[model samples]
Target: MAILTNARMPVETVNFHLWQPCNMKCRFCFATFRDVRGTVLPEGHLPRRDAERVVTLLADAGFTKITFAGGEPLLCPWIIDLIRLAKGLGLTTALVTNGSLIDSGTIRDLRGILDWVTVSVDSVRSGTLALIGRMTAARAADERHYLDLCDRLKDAGLRLKINTVVTAANHLEDLTGFIVAARPERWKIFEVLPVQGQNSGKVEPLLVTPGQFARFVARSRSVEAYGIRVVPEDNDAMIGSYAMVDPAGRFFDAIGNGYTYSEPILRVGVRQAVSQVTVSRRKFLARGGLY
Candidate 1:
C-alpha cells in the first residue's frame, strides 16, 4: 500500500509492448489474452508520431530506462527508429525478443542504439524447444541461429540477457551449456504463469509445481561458475513489479487473474494513466529494474 513518496520520484524503468503480432506460437504466451478465438487481432501499436510523443513524454516525466517488448518487438517496422528516438532522449533502451527473427542484419542495425538485448530461450535441447512449440521444424538450426545471434550481439558491444520460462515441459533440461556459450550479463528464469483468459486452460499441463521450480533453480546454479547471474521470478514476484505500457499506450498490471489496463496515455496523459496501475517500488528494486 505504499505509494511513491513524490510525484517526481524518478521511474527507473518502463516496458512497452509495441505490437501484438508474433511469428512463433509458443504454448505459454501470456499475450495470448489480446487475441480473439484463434484470429489475429488488429495491430495495436500506436502510430509512429504518437509513439514518439509517448516516449518523449515518459522520458521527460523521469523515466530513465525504456524496454521495448511485444508479441515480437522485431515485427514492428519502426522498432529501430523507436530505439533511436529513445536514445536521442537520453533514455537507456532495451529490447526483449524471441530471437527467431534475429539475424546478422538485425543485430547490425541494433548496434549502438540498443543498450540491452534479452532473448527468450526456454531450453537448450532442440527436442524440448519443438515439444514446447517454440519452433515447428529445424529446431536444431533455430537453436544454432539463436546462439550465433547472441554472439553477434555481444560482438556489436550490446549487453545481453536471457529469459527462460521454466515450465513442466523443459524444467528438467540442463541449460548450463547454453548459459556458458551465450555468456549473457543476466539470465532471468520465470515460473510458468497462468493468466485466467490467456493461456490458463490450454497450458495447464505445462505448469510446474513449486517443488519442481525449486529443483530447476538449484540445477541452474551450475552456470554461476561461468559468471552468469541468474535471477528467478515466480508469479508473486513478477506481478506488480513491472511498469508496463501495452501496445495501445495504456498502462497495465497483472496483479490479479487477468490484466487491468488504464485509459490510453494519449487520451488521459501519462500521469493519470500511470496512476491507474499499481507499481511496487520494493519489488521493482529487488528485480534490479533500476539502473
Candidate 2:
C-alpha cells in the first residue's frame, strides 16, 4: 500500500531496497530469508526510467539522503548507476549491506558515490555461525570477512558503520570482541524484533525488556572507554527524528511495520511517492509510534 499524501509529514530517509533476494540465509532476517527462496517481486526492482524518476522525485521532495539496500544490493547490476544518479542530484547516498558480496571491485565503484556504508555484523564467533545457520563460512570466517571488507572500505577511505542486531542469542555474551575488533566509526545496537520472521508475532516476548535495554545502553556506552562510539536506538528522542523507507520506497513507520502507506509507492516513481508522502510528516510521525 502507498502512503496517503498529506501536508504534514517529513521525509527524512528514502530507502530503495531493490531486491528481497539475498546470498546469505541469516536466521534473524525479519524478511524470513529461510522460508522464501529469495524472490525479487515484479515490483521490487526499479527499471532505469523508474530509478531516474525516483531520484528526480527525491530531489523535488527535498530529501538529502537516499539509501540503497537489498537482499544484497550489489545483486542489482544497476545499483552503481542509481548511486551516481543520486549524487548527480546533490543527494547524499548510503548503503545497508550484509558485507558478504562486497569486494575490491565494488569498493572501487563506490569510492565517491556513497557517503556511508552500514554493514551488519551480528556476531564474530565461529561457533555462532552454526547457530545463525551460516556454518558454511563458519561464524568466525563471516565476521573476519566482514571486518576485512570494512578494513578494505576504510582503507579506500570510505565512511563505515558496523551495525549489530542484539538478540536473545547473544545478549549476555561479551560484545567487547566486536568493539575491540571491528572498531568502526559507529557501532549501532538494535533490539531484535520479530518482523524478520513469520512467527514474529512472538518477537516482543523475545526482546530485551526496558530494564534490559537500559542495561544494554550502559554496557554499550562503556565501549567508548575502549575507543569505539556506541549509538543505542532505545527510547532516544532523536530516533523519532529519523524515518526509513523500504526497498519499494515505502516509508517505514517503524523497522518492520510494513509500508505505512496504502498504495505501492513505486507506482508513481520515487520522486512523486516521496513528495506525496513527506508533505504529511506530522501525522506520519504521530501515527501511533514508539521510536
Candidate 3:
C-alpha cells in the first residue's frame, strides 16, 4: 500500500530544510555543509509570511507533497502553520524531526495538520547514541522516551516513520528489536553520505563500507513480517532522487563529488529554481517518494 497519497504532478515531493539550528550535534550530519566555516548559521527560520508564500508557490506549481525537514524542524515556531498551510492547499505534508522536542502538547497541536512524521533514531543502544553525539546523557532514558513518543503518535492516529542513519558506529548493532518495538509504518535506513564541505574529512572514522552496509540490510529484513517497510538509500541511490531546498530556500542537489545549488525559489521562481536541479523521476518513484 502507498504510504501517503498525493495528486499527480511534475515534482511529486520536495524536502525543505526549514532551519539549520539543532539541539543535538550528530557526528554525521550532512547539513553541516551548509555552514562549512561554522560561522554563519541562520539565526532563525524563514519568516512566517515568506514560508507561507513558498508553500503556496509549491502547491501552485503542482507539487503534491511538502516535507518540512531541518537541523531540527520542531524548533521552527512556524512549523505547524506551514504544515497547516500545505495541507490547506491540498498537499500531503510530512515532518522530519529529531524526536527530542515531541511531547503530548506538541503532538496534540500537530494532530490534523501532519500526514507523516519521521523521527531520527540511529541506534537502540544508549552507548551508541552517546558515541554518535546524539545524546548528552541518560542514553537509556532517552531511548525509552523516544519509544514512548512513537506509541503516543500512533495512538493519536498519525502515520509514523523512523529514520536510522547507518554509520560505522551503529551499522553492526542489530536493530530488529527496535524495529519490532516501534512498529513504524516505514523505516528508512540511509547510508552516511560524505559532503565535500560537511563531515567529509571528519567522518572517515564513522564511514561504513558497502559490504558492512549490505550485511546490515540483510539483517534488517526480519522486520518485514511485522508489516514495517524498510527503505534503504545508499549514496548512489540518493543523488538526484531527492528534491531538496536549503534553509535559505535555494534548491540544491549532489552532482559528481560536490554540490550544486540554484537561486532561491522566491527570487527566481519555483520553475526556474527547480529547473537548475536534476530530479530522477524513476528513482523517486522506485524509492516510494511519491504517494
Per lDDT, the best of the predicted structures is 1
Distance from true position, residue 160, model 1, in Å? Answer: 0.6
Candidate 2 residue runs with Cα over 4 Å from true position: 1-11, 31-40, 134-143, 196-206, 235-242, 254-259, 266-291
lDDT of 3 by residue, 217-236 (tens): 88998999999999988888
What does the lDDT read for residue 284 in candidate 3?
86
Could you give candidate 1's per-residue lDDT for residues 1-291 as a string of tens digits? 225556652257999887777777778888753643233225556778988888888887778899999878998888999999999999999999988778778888898899999999897677787777787444533557778878889999999999999999998888888788889989999999888776766678899999888899899888988888988888788888887887778788888768887877888877778888888888988877665
For all predicted structures, in order, the TM-scores are 0.93, 0.76, 0.92
Cα-lDDT of candidate 3: 0.81
lDDT of 2: 0.61
Could you give candidate 2's per-residue lDDT for residues 204-239 as a string of tens digits? 544666667667667778678777777765533223
Window of ten residues with lowest summed lDDT in model 3: 1-10
> Against the hidden true structure, what lDDT does model 1 obtain?
0.81
Error of 2 at 133 (Å): 3.9
| Ranked candidates (lDDT, high to low) | 1, 3, 2
Q: Which RMSD does model 3 reach against the true structure? A: 4.0
Candidate 1 TM-score over all chains jointly: 0.93
RMSD of 2: 5.1
Report, for every candidate in turn, its global Cα lDDT versus the true structure.
0.81, 0.61, 0.81
